[model samples]
Every structure is written in structure tokens, then in C-alpha cells.
Target: MERFTPTRYTLTCVASGREFEDEGWTLDDPECGEPSLVRARYAERQLNVRDDAYGIYRFCDWLPIRRTLRGSHAPVTYKSRKLAEYLGLENLYITFSGYFPEVGARMTTCSFKETEAYNVCARRAEGEERVLVVASAGNTARAFAKVCSDNRIPLLLSVPEDNIGALWFEEPLDPCVKLIAPCCGGDYFDAIHLSNLALSSPRCYAEGGAKNVARRDGMGTTVLSAATAIGEIPDYYFQAVGSGTGAIAAWEANLRLIEDGRFGNKLMRLMVSQNAPFTPMYDAWRAGSREMLPYDADQARADAEAIDAKVLSNRKPPYSLHGGLYDALVATDGDVLVATNEEAREARRLFEELEGVDIYSAAGVALATLIRAVREGRVERDKIVMLNVTGGGEERFRRERGNRVWNLRPHRVFPLDADKEQVVRAVEELFA
Candidate 1:
């Protein structure tokens, strides 16, 4: 077995600015009563891109983990010519996190969520052997499943049965990965509910949603890669939000870049988008309120079902939490845009036609917002822009890899409203 040393870093309370050693795997400051994010303060203040490492690990100086899972897998950033011209933009750049072989984007899961899954597992792998538990609408569960399976790390994924079709993979599923689906009619939130119940077991640990620093920092690499590829910080950053984790990650990454003294000083104007009818963050932000009001469960579920991007339907997002999406948006002077299902569909078609690669529906929402921003003069044509196509290449991936059911059937399926005792029994049986 190859033992790896932990990275040199400290955990700093985002609210108090107090620092502590990387004592263990932690999500929150136990000492602080208020909710706050704990950021990793790396020893290296200056970033020198390591050309020797593969993919996102090249920035391992900033990543929480010291070990490298070198595959040609990482987000690829490039200047857009045809798409830029079509959109009538001068300096449009796209950071694609998918299986676009032409540009060397080899995210086998075809989602930026892979970045979060990889780092979260790697960080925990350095510590004890707790089974990771995660809940998602679709993309995230698949990403976690793929990365955990590839690394031979144990993980339990809970997803709504409606979204289980999205969990297919190109390669055969590893036995280490266990998946549970809620057969009872449930959305993403119900999956989360079941996952929370499942976490009651001592052997299982929550993946800490957006509160996990490793997940945030891992996704932040998209911004870092784009800044390095563009040779400067972009004036505008665009991405579609579910829990707004990626946008928060982008903001955090830009902050580090600004501190590095090489990238431009100004923060990129964050232009995050959400699918319409189910836009909690957008409504809250537009109301100029940090707090998000809860939506009626039935209404939210119906709206989420109607949307083209079901993955962007997080009900209880980490918006108002300290050092979260609200703070990130305020720091960047960001604005949230809403994209209707029709708009997102059109945008997806346009992007695929012009960019020569199929994009995820959430990416279409982001692209639609970019178009809206351009029309509203929120973003100037000449300003440097980084559009994060968070996920894509599903059609291409399926075409090339064929429809081989990796794990032909899920490990188990349970009701969304299953009791704690039932969940615990299922977990015990699976692990036993």
C-alpha cells in the first residue's frame, strides 16, 4: 500500500478568521455557535502551476489532498470562435467539464460534480474508513458513484427513482459503490431526507453538501484553470446553479487568484442562472434578501418536474449560510437570472449546433442567461468572459461507449419516507 502525506494546510473559520491545524476531517467549526464555512488556508500563498501533474491535481498545491489520481481527467478551458461569433461576443471563453475529446475534456462522468466527488473522497481517504453517503437529483450521485467506484472507495448514493436513469455509466460499476433509490414519489429533497436518515448509522457519514471545503475547492479549479488559460481573471463568470456551490467555488478561486498577485485584482461579475418556476435563489437574490423563504413542497416538486434541468432543483440551498452563496454573490456584485424551460431548450440546441458538442440542460440555462446579459448590456461584448458549461457530452458519451448498463440494477431501493430504523437495517445489510 502506498501511504501519502497530508498537504500542508490550516482550517480557518470564515467568520472569526481563527486558524487551526488540519486535525481531522471536519465540516463545521464546533467552537463557533453560528453557521460558518471553514476554508483551507494553504501554506503556499503564491501559485505556480505544476505542469508535471495531470488534470486538476496540477493545482494540488491548493487542493486539500496531497495524493494524485492522475487520469487525463480535468476541466478544459478554451477560447470560443464560432460560438463567440454567433453570440456576437469578442472575448468569449468556455471552460467545458465533459467528454469532448477534441479539447481534451475527459471527465468520464461528464459533469463538474466529478471534481467535488474526487476531492471529497480523497480528503476523507486520508483519515478513517467511514462510508460516504450522498444524496442528489441525478448528476451529483452519478459523479460520486463514478469517482468512488474508480478509486475503490465505499459510498452510498441516494437518488429519486425518477432520476435513476441518469446514473448510467460507461464503465462497469465497482462493487465498492452502493446505490439506493427511493421508489416512492420523491424529488431531490426527499432523497436528501432519506440520506439524512441513513446517516444515523455510525459507519456512515454525510458528504456535507456545500459545507465541505474539499468539494468547494475541488470545483474551484474550473475558475483557476480558466484564469491560467486566459492569462488573467475574466471580467464576467457564467455558470448554472443548483445549490450555487459552483458559483461560490468560482468566487473563492478568484479570491485566491487575486491574492496570488498575478491575476487581475477585480472580482469577476458572477452571472449565475437558475431554471424558471423553481428558482428559489434567484427570487431571494432579486428581492435583495439574503434569506430564502421555503416553497410549498407540492409546488416546488411540480415546478422541478416541469424544468428541463432537474438537477438544479435544490430546495434548501446553502445561500444564507456564512461564507456561502449569498456572501459570494455580494462579494462579486453578482446577479441571478432565470431561464425558462423553452429558453434552456433553445439554448441547448444552439450551443450544440454552434459548439459541436452536446451540453447539459443546466449549461443551456447558463448560456441563455449569458445571452440575456449580453442583450441587457450587463456584459460588454469586449469584456473577457468565462462560461462554465458545467456538464455535457451525454449524447456523445453514449454514442461512443454504447448503452451498457454498468450496474444493471441498483444495489437497493427504498421509499423516500422510509423510517430511520429501516434505513439503518438496509445500510447494515449492505455493508455486512
Candidate 2:
């Protein structure tokens, strides 16, 4: 594991809309477009603290539990030239933290969840009987599995069975982490429901996801890393999002850097992309609305569920909060893109051909969004730009004997109305 550090600090409320403290850090509060001024300087690592307690998110260095990239999982090299040409920006850079090995960007979980999982558990209470419970569609589960295995920490992960085997790599099962695959045909929403129940168990503590400052700050490391590699923050930031967590993370990280007196506090124009059928935020943004309709939620979520990377889609996003995602987009003049699967596939191919690496579907969507931004002239070509590729490069992973699945289907399927005792007995049998 890499040594993580903190450069500055601040606090915000998920339930409320207020800045609690800066503690020596600068702030770039974005609601749409670029921040007018920056309190901090540029090109340095910083930590963004949303909540005062729980987890700390360092912007630059991201350590993933006990996993190493020496033999099996090499490293991904960071390259910014190709991305610069695509966005037509002078100092544009691409943050490679997935499967690409040229720059040693080996993120074991493949997904960005590695940012959250390793950071959270690494600083947790040591030797405590901790039962960490999480809800995921796929990527987060894989990240948790890798973390638990590497760190030897006990974890309870719940996910839809359909998404279970689809996770990119099959890591060896760690006895401490139990993978609960939903019995009934379901999606991420169902997984969240089951995760809620698992967290309620006496022995476990739910990873307060959205409210967990560590997860968001951890995910923000990509931005810090990107800016660090490029020597400054970009004018435009782009990515594929489900819950908009990564975008939120990037916004928060830049805000912290602005306060630290090291980075310019310009709120990069965020461009978040999603699969067309499941693009609730994209649809809502296109319809000229800040809030999402319930009907839109159902359609977007279902559409996201219809895809191979269903885990990337989050129904309830951080946009609901003031100065949140919706607030950031509106403030920074951000844009959203919804691409059809066909478009995503084409985008992926184009990117692979030009960049010379296969990308995951989520990355494809993000690339598509970047394309839209470039064509519309939404991005300022002369300024700096950064694109976050969430995941990719499966064909490169075939070298390792990496295919395994611990089939821990829920002990028993339960109805929504299933009595507590019945649920208790079914779970108790695992202990028995």
C-alpha cells in the first residue's frame, strides 16, 4: 500500500447546505462554470474533507489495501498527449488508473471503487471486529473483495447475481468478506436493499457511502493525480457517471486545492456521460430541469440496469444537495451527454484505435461525452483539459490465471414482507 497524506481540510453537510470549516484549506465553490477565484495554488496534492469525521480523502496518492502490481497486475502509464488532441486543448491530459500498464496505473479493482475501498479500510480501527457492509452493482464489490483479501478485513458485500460473474477479474476469496448474490432476478437497487438489511445486522457497520467523506475524497484522487501529472488543473473535466459521485469527488478535490494555496480554484466544466436508455440526469438536463422526476429515475435506472456495467448507475445522486452535483453543473456551466450503446461502442472503438487500448463501457460513454463537448465547442481549446477513463483493457488481463467466483448466494430469498424472525433465522444459519 502507498503512503497517503493530507495537505488541507474543510467540512460540508450532506443533509444541510453550509460550509463548516476550512482549517487552512482554500475553497472553490462551484454551482456552474469556472470558479471566479482560487484561494490555493496549482499542481499539488490536497485532501478534501466533506464531513469532519469517518474517513480522510487525500487527493494525490491512492493506496489500494495490500495489493501489489509487480507481477500479475502491472501498472498503467499516465498519458495526456492523445487526450489533448481529442479535446483540442493545449495542456490536456488523460488520467490512467485502470488496466493500462505503460504508466503504472494499476488499479486492482479495475473500477474507481478501489479509490474508496482501500482508503476507507486502510485507516479503519485496527484489530476491531469490523463487519463492513456495502451495496454494489459490480465494480465496488470487486474493489471490496480485492481490499478485504489484501488487508484480511471482514466485509459483507451484497449485489445482484447477474452482476456477480460479470466483474472483470476473479480474485481469490478472502474468508473475511462474504459476497451475497441476490437470489431473485434483480439489479443494483435490489442490491442496495439487501445491503441495507445486511448493515442492520448487529455485527456490521454500513459504509455510509454518499455521506462518507473518504469515499468521495478517495475518488477525487484521480483529479489530483491528473492535475499533478499535467502540472495544473484542467479547464474542462469529463467522465462517465452513474450516481455522479466521481464528478462530485473531482469538484470537491479541486475546491480543497484552491484553498491550499497551491492550485487554481477554477471549477472545471464538468461533462458527465451515461448510457442513453439509463440517462436520467442527461435526460433531465436536456429537458431543462435541475431536479429529476421520479418517472425519470425509473427510466434512467432501468436503462442503466439494461446495460453490462449496470453498477455505474446510481438512482439517487449527490445532486440533490445544494453545492452538490446539480449545483456544480449549474455553477460551472457543466453539460451532460447521453449516448446510445451503439454510439458507446463506436466511441470505444475509435478511442482504442487512436489511443491503442480497449476501454470499458463506462469509459466509452465518457469518451462519447468528451466528443460531444468538443463538437459543440463547449471546451476552451487553449486551456487545460482532463478526461477520466473509469475502466478498460480486458484483453491485456488474459495473461494472468484470473478467473474465479465465490458463489455466496443469499442464504435464502426473502419477500419484501418476509418477517424479521424468518430473515434472522435464514442469516443465522450461516453462523450456525
Each candidate structure's TM-score, on Cα atoms with residue i matched to residue i, is 0.96, 0.80
lDDT minimum window of 10 residues, candidate 1: 401-410
The alpha-carbon lDDT assigned to residue 149 of candidate 1 equals 76
True-vs-predicted CA distance for residue 316, candidate 1, Å: 0.5
lDDT of 1 by residue, 208-253 (tens): 9888888999999999889999999999999999999999889989
TM-score of 1: 0.96
Residue 351's C-alpha lDDT in candidate 2? Answer: 78
Query: Best candidate per TM-score, number?
Result: 1
Candidate 2 has a TM-score of 0.80
| Model 2, span 1-432: residue lDDT tens | 344344333444433333444332213333324322222222334433232112223232332222221212211226566756665667657776566665565564556677777665654556557577888878777777677766777777777766766444454565676666565456677677776765556767777575555566667777777765566667888888888878887886677656665567677888888776776677678887777756543464457567655756677665655546786788778888777788778888887877877778888888787777778877667767677887765555544435333333443555533454554455545534
Clash pairs, candidate 1, are none
The per-residue C-alpha lDDT of model 2 at residue 425 equals: 51
Best by lDDT: 1
